[model samples]
Target: MAKYNKVVLAYSGGLDTSIIIPWLKENYGCEVICVAGNVGQDAELDGLEERALKTGASKLYIEDIQDEFVNDFVFPTLKAGAKYENYLLGTSFARPPIAKRIVEIAKKEGADAICHGCTGKGNDQVRFELTIKALAPEMPIIAPWRTWELKSRDEEIDYAIAHDVPIKITRETNYSKDMNLWHLSHEGLDLEDPANEPQYAKEGFLEMGVAPEQAPDKPTYITLSFEKGIPVALDGEKMDGVTMIKTLNKLGGENGIGLLDIVENRLVGMKSRGVYETPGGTILYHAHEVLETICLDKMTQHYKQKLALEFADLVYNGQWYTPLREAMSAFVDKTQETVTGEVKLKLYKGNIINAGVTSPYTLYDEEVATFGEDEVYNQADSAGFINLFGLPIKVKALLDQKREQK
Candidate 1:
């Protein structure tokens, strides 16, 4: 008896997904429809349809969700300033939109169940399944890694070889990697051991950018314009969101601007070490932060900073579809109304330096802030303000002094 009449698998044509097409067919005895959401993993999609069909998929639907990804997922999170333990939530937020698209395709195809190649122990499983559950509550999810006998990547490779499923990676060079327009992450292999340093100089290890040491000696300056917290232009030229990111990626990568090495706590309750290259994303984050400093008021900015922490946790835990995330996004959107600005940055090796920033809504009053002869600010009023502010401290100290004297 077949468990499902048809299954829509979230296919990336990676090593795990390449073999899954055959595995699903063999085990479920059902037609497999593959859905590959294109969130700007450029060359990774090359010949993906052919590979999926060759491995026994009924058909492949490649959805181009890049613009939606940037506008909906990336920008919203950027506005929130969400960073999961300094990890820009690159892979975290990318999952929701991809999974949402998968659900759409599954409904369109009338597939009885949805499938994904995410492993049992990783965060991606939770991310994919959560989105699926949120969107289509009744639909079943087939996670082969949880049920199948293939215990390791080595076994998966062997299974791929035995099944004649074409895979791009070999055993010697098999590193678990996830790439998109925002970033490229490297894990597994030497990276699994926290004590071992990543081999950035290795020929195939880095795809997005060079090692910081390999970057040019000179600094590169560029201007970025933002409207309502979303990047709108690069180097004084108006550009679409996609073009702006791509251009920044090229420039940031060449200058070695964004390389992160961290041992992060995964949602599955285990610590994982990975090296992430997010040249363009890093640049954007820095520039946006610079713009907000002059634009946002002190209290609102401080409150948003606290909110950003919770926002990061939600995104990292695959709670993108939850009400809390939606509410926080609404709050973030409200804060971004005055975030329109231009930021000038100098990119040096593995560093982003703010050259200048300006906004029509800037609250920085030089007359009030200047140390020398500021006419706008009333210096005499600070005496009353300070006395009022320090009254609680003075009362507490007086009580303590009386207790000591007694």
Candidate 2:
């Protein structure tokens, strides 16, 4: 008597997911349908269909969501300047869209349950399950790490060998990873110790780019154009979403632009260390930030800064499908109406130096801002304006003086 007759599993051609297909069938007597979302993990998708079927899956649906990921998830978060604990929300924001598609495929196949490979100790389990709960409440969710007797990835590897399930990763090179168009994150292995500096070279784990020290000596300049707070062109060339990310990824990676090693607090109240590489995303966030300073007014920009922190916290904790995130996005989109502009930057080693920035919506007026002789700004106007602005302080000082005399 099977509990679930049909189950949809979020499948990557990786160790955990590869084993889960057979496990689901054996334990629950269910037909398994696997869904893989392609968010720009280039080489990770090879022979996925064959692999899924070989492992007992009835079918595999590989969805290409790179454009939607960038436009809907990446850009909006960028527009808000959202960075979780100073780390870009690469893996965090990525979970929602992928899970949304998983839910869609499950509905199409009339699946009785949804399953994922996220561990109980990690943040991704909460992310994946919360998305399922929001979009398809009736569908039951399965987490193997919560139920399976296997203790660690090493035990899982032994199980895989026993079951004749093929995997490229050996225990020696085993590092948990999540990759998408915006960023790639690495965890586990030697990274378990917070004191350990990542052995990126020995592990051969850097997929995005080189270390900053190994970068080329010379600097490279690039001109980026934005329309309505979205990047439209690079160095005077128009590009589509995926192509733009690919182009900037090459430039930023070669220049050693984006890499971070941090011990972060997870959604499930655990502390974990990981290495995150977000080459192009680092550039886009910085460039958009400078452009907004020129384009947006003082109050809007400062207020958005506060909201950006809140936005980052929400996305990092996997509340993407909630109304709060939707409301935050509304404010971000409205602020981006005049964020059209161009910015030129010099990329040298790990530094992104701002060369130039311009926008038709720029509020900067040379006549009003000049240090030299200017016709518009009257220097004498400061006296009356400062007095009026400081009237509260002046009154307080007088009252304090009278109290002191008494």
Please report the candidate that would top TM-score against the real structure: 1
Tens-place lDDT per residue, model 1, 1-406, is 3489899999999988889988988888899999999999999999999999999999999999999999899989998999999999889989999999999988988899999999988999999989999999999988889999999999999999999999999888888999998999988987889889888877778888888888899999999999999999998799988888889899999988788999999999989998999999999999999999999999999999999999999999999999999999999999999999999999988789889999999999888788998668888899999999999999999999999999
| Location of the lowest summed lDDT over 10 successive residues in candidate 1 | 200-209
Off by over 4 Å in 1: none
Model 2, span 1-406: residue lDDT tens: 3499999999998999999988898899999999999998888999999989988899999999998888888888998999988899999888989999999999999999999999889888888988999999988899998998898999999989988888889998898998888889999988999988886555367889888888899999999999999999999999987888889999999998998899888878888898998989999998999899899999999999999999999999889888999999999999999999999999998899999999999999988898999889888999999999999999999999999999
lDDT scores of the candidates, listed in order:
0.92, 0.91
Q: Residue 286's C-alpha lDDT in candidate 2?
A: 89
Error of 1 at 217 (Å): 1.1
Listed in order, each prediction's TM-score against the native is 0.98, 0.96
